[model samples]
Target: MAGSTLDESVTAFLKNHASNDAFEETDPVKASQKLFPEIAYTDTEKAELSQWLITASHVGSNTEDAAKAAERLSTLNTHLSSRTTLLGAKPSVADIALYQHLASVVSKWSAEERTGEQGYHHIVRHIDFVQNSPLFGLKLDEKVHIDADNVVFKIKPIDAKAEKERKKKEKEAAAAGAVASGATPTTLTGDQGAEGKKSKKDKVKDKAQAAGDAVASTVVGKPGAPEGAPTKKKEKKEKQPKPQKAAPVEKPLSPSLIDLRVGHILKATTHPNADSLYVSTIACGDPPGTDNTSEFEGQVVRTVCSGLNGLIPLEEMQNRKIVTVCNLKPVTMRGVKSCAMVLAASPRVAEGEDSHKGPVELVNPPADSKAGDRVYFEGWEGEPEGVLNPKKKVWETIQPGFTTTDALEVGFDVEAVPQLSGEGAEKKTGVGKLKTAAGLCSVSTLKGATVR
Candidate 1:
């Protein structure tokens, strides 16, 4: 019988039966007989469907294995093309099983790979037919359209009821915890009273205090003396004076937690999907020092995606030595994956003026410094984070430290020029000087610019 007719018959038979013990069968044979008691298949047809299921399971084992399985399925599909089903003319268990297997495998294949010159048209047809049949239990709205081949296929639908229940349970658990802690349970939207409100800084402080309390509990025993017994006062030890040791010198503050390196742009191109972005391949040299086992130690070609399309002309990008954040996580801009970020400084636009027309200059490296060389402030020495998580606010904290001076020295040192009161009197007090490692990344041009 046709799949629609079979579905109708199964529905009608199930509707007519109302026995509570009908689903109590536990044995595999008994369960199968109870569920599909009327549907019967020949031994040869059953064997063929079993073979197809076994073959489909091995589809993605490896390239060779997948190709072999595809070839077998293609041949089988070709043979069954003239028939409505895998066996004879009517849809059967064999047809359903084989169609399901094909559908499962097809979802994994890319649109181009699914319908190429050597594609299995018959398998695709069979999948489309089975998915549209009443027995599939899939709605038309659930089908996704593949633009490349103009084929519509059903994707796995999410269980909305289960998801809702999971979220509800989570909310209940949070509410319970809040009640236990003597705090009012607030809605997920956080529209609590002003008395319960906490700023971001306040929240961070609370978290830090909680962490400190946990650490203190681990280190020292719980508060108060052990049960009973009067507490004895301990005598303090006498202080002894010894030879004074040299005071430890304070280290300079680093401008950023980012691993800024000198890199030479090897290739630059406008991003196909975004007009404001430029995709460039940069060559950053290996890590400094010997015996380094870091994977990034050797010469690395990092793909950098930047929004300097309008600011920097395409021709000027070639062989340009630019400062790059070498340790940033790879991000996909448009369709291309970028592994690094180029550094540039642009002056802040005046209240009434546009900043785009202002001169945006790239931070220049020292003439002696080569690609891959680490850029450090004058007094600090340490490695940058391998990869910075923006969520941690590391970049946000150090961004203000990067600035230029009137003298055009492009470094991290903040210099303050004092107004002259008198010739004899001291001119000004030096303040706000940024302390960086010995080496500084600089640019010859001194126009006021903001480093990004």
Candidate 2:
């Protein structure tokens, strides 16, 4: 803070954003409400602003209490978790007060302190948004450099509508409390308390169903018609054994059971809720109306979420060809459901080592290949299953065999996975290079690495 943390926010705001008319007002509170925010703060929000201002004033004082500051900041962080600003997507003077007191403090924090499990992540994000975002229009020279990709813990964002509903319920409950004290609740009315009431349409539907049931009773035999006994005419036919349906012939255990394809990443953005995942729009050659796919920029695309935010540069993920496992059942990651897996290569880590700590490279299909082109381990080529069954664990069993060769080519080494090497296994021998019609799938630098 320029002088004192308490005064800096107003001083900065008055200098940067206040109009000349605001200068005529000597009182800080009135000037703030006059020039700082265009939106009207609710009574509750006004109380919040007053409370936070008192907390901000405590900073750099002999009477300062660290625990109280942490508690207040945490509550504010929770409130801001579901909102873009203190006023839910609209900037307010309370934010400026928060930033002035915490900007220098946040600048000195290590990555762990900024985004670790115990870190004040939402506060850091709030500060960054205030300074850089056009909405606030604050142009301070000394800004904190918080790395967006280095977040250690991911918090699922709270839905704004849910928060509003919760607040509404709290207000209604407060009104009910007044009702208990003999005051009439504005909520009660003739049309209210409809817990068991049916609408006219619903009653009509029920009456129609009852009439149809009465008619159906005539043809279905009277209510007391000896339950399972058939009529004389029906019993006249000879009983015949129905032919048993032939069992489905299961495909032999093979790596080909996992459908792999050459996919083109149309665009990608970091997952809003997950720190280490990328939400991508990928073209996988699916026709229009294909399951789990949506049209994007004139192409049928699947929204895939991959845990590659820090591992892969987001720019490299755009407009690139990579191998993808298409048959894996869609899994919801964070809040987004990933329809397919983006194949990448990472070095074989020791048992206790973090497998995700990478020098990772996305396994690239040949540049000329089109999206949705069939990609398979050469020696195990066959028709891939439509969707691999989770109970079968086919992918879990076969993924260990997926590896990169000494020549940087992606392949399935049969010897590495013994379960797929014998008896009922598909007749595949040695390492089979993964390829499409255009060319081989290869990683840039991670040769002899695991491909998954």
| lDDT of each candidate versus the true structure | 0.55, 0.73
What does the lDDT read for residue 343 in candidate 1? 75
Shift of residue 26 alpha carbon in model 2, Å: 96
The per-residue C-alpha lDDT of model 2 at residue 61 equals 38
lDDT of 2 by residue, 1-452 (tens): 22212364455555764344443443444544555443455676656655656555554233557887677667766766545566553345556666777777778878877778887777887787666643345557567787767778765444446667999999999998887754444335565434226566986997899999989988676655576887655557677999999998899889988888878898999999989999999988664445677767645688899989988899999888887888899999988999999999999999999999999999988876767667877778677788998999898889899999889999999977877676455654689999875678888888889988
lDDT assessment of candidate 2: 0.73
> Which window of ten consecutive residues has the lowest lDDT sum in model 1?
288-297
lDDT of 1 by residue, 13-101 (tens): 23343122322532322322344343355666655544543444343234456668767766765554334455543344344445433
